[model samples]
Target: MTTNILFCGDASMTDGVLIATLSLMKQTRHPLHIFILTATLTVNGHHYRPFAAGTAERMTKLMQTQNSAHQLTRIDITDLFVADLPRANMKTMFTPYCMLRLFSDLVPELPDRVLYLDTDVVCRRPFDTFYNQSMAGVDIAGVLDHYGKWWFHHRLAWFDYLNSGVLLMSLAHIREDGLLVRCRQLVRHRWLFMPDQSALNIKAKFKRILPRKYNEQHQLKPDTVFQHFTTFFRFWPYFRIVTVKPWQIQAVHQQLGLHEYDDLLKDYRQLAPKLKEVS
Candidate 1:
């Protein structure tokens, strides 16, 4: 069976997505059916460009190199986003593109089960075990946010708050229960700090909290499967938020001091120049 992976972002997220894809490809030999959801939107004066078709074409070719069955499909949800705009959170720190995953149920092409990953993540270990885990009654499966869990919980502070960066979604359950519809309504009408993540936490009826190894947001451990480069706060010298992504090769080497993915980084460096030509 092919693993259905999903990523949502705009054109600015191209490098992150490409590097994340490379990391996944290196870890597992399983047939991957990757779906990239992108959209063009103009909230206020800022215009966001959708993922380029040429980049998608290049990525499709790259995926097939590992396994003939591996495929990459780019789905543009411009019209859907235009119809149901998240008006309340449009001006938040996050771009409007971050809400794209909330429209996944409306996309006819998506599989019943899709693993949604944020662009700023790298796979360190094969996650077929996590991907193939039974989702019989769970609408979504995710790990607790390293930072958000302490403050953003719906009921129990640490137990209910889940990070949206790496989620194993049950699309069938979400559609049947109208989960995304409620999430969309919540974000469109109400202002949330982390709109999508908060809406999911509040509205999802059944969610499974996985081990931290599934989405290790902090320092990477030996058993970490997906290393998420999420923004975290540091208070030693002075209180400041740190943000770093896998695509930031120099930051990953210098700031993060991570050298485990040298092979993947080398491949990303070689392939990155071609993105400029495509864009």
Candidate 2:
């Protein structure tokens, strides 16, 4: 059978997500198809092609010397969505809010449903239980907000904070519906941080299916294998500017190795070698 899993990340991002994803492909019990949706260039001019695709292939190759990327498929955004990514997202591009919007736009016209993942996630165990569940009755399976209602609606709803880390949903509902259109309108209106999220929260209002250990945003237990790195940038030096706490990233980085953090720091021009190169 065909199970569609969606992930969004760029080349400049740390190789941790890349490693996590590859490892998951190796462990998944199904046919293990992966669809990566990422643009070729960053708004800053960094190239995503050689690094993202090349590393993915290298990792996959290393995992199974006899295997190809069959268990893994990459949806090159460079081949599809170019930088014309709506002009309104100028300020919020990397925010959690923007990731949701970009992910919504990347849904392809496919027969199978999609399990959208943030690049920061890794599967510690076979997630067949979560994957095979019925999403037909709900828009997605995600976390219920313990913090409070969607930040935008908190003043009005007084509910939980519904985080959008990992989601299993159908493309049909997003495409042939009013959600995507509303996202476009909100972006055009310059609503900023919550454009796509606003639409998603509104559409799936009170309908999120809290999966069993599926949306675990924190550390995983002994039985838990699939881990979604929800806190990659919480401690980001830019945290003061962005204001969101980074979580679960330090631990995940241990298995991914130094090269990942090495490059990520370089991407930010915070590394000495990278700085010397630029100078």
Predicted model with the maximum TM-score: 1
lDDT of 2 by residue, 137-166 (tens): 465567654232434453354554456657
Q: What is the lDDT of candidate 1?
A: 0.89
Which lDDT value does model 2 have at 10? 59
Task: Identify the leading candidate in terms of lDDT.
Answer: 1
Q: After aligning candidate 1 to the native by TM-score, how far in Å is the CA of 275 from where it should be?
A: 3.5
Minimal lDDT window, size 10, model 1: 151-160
The TM-scores, one per candidate, come to 0.96, 0.66
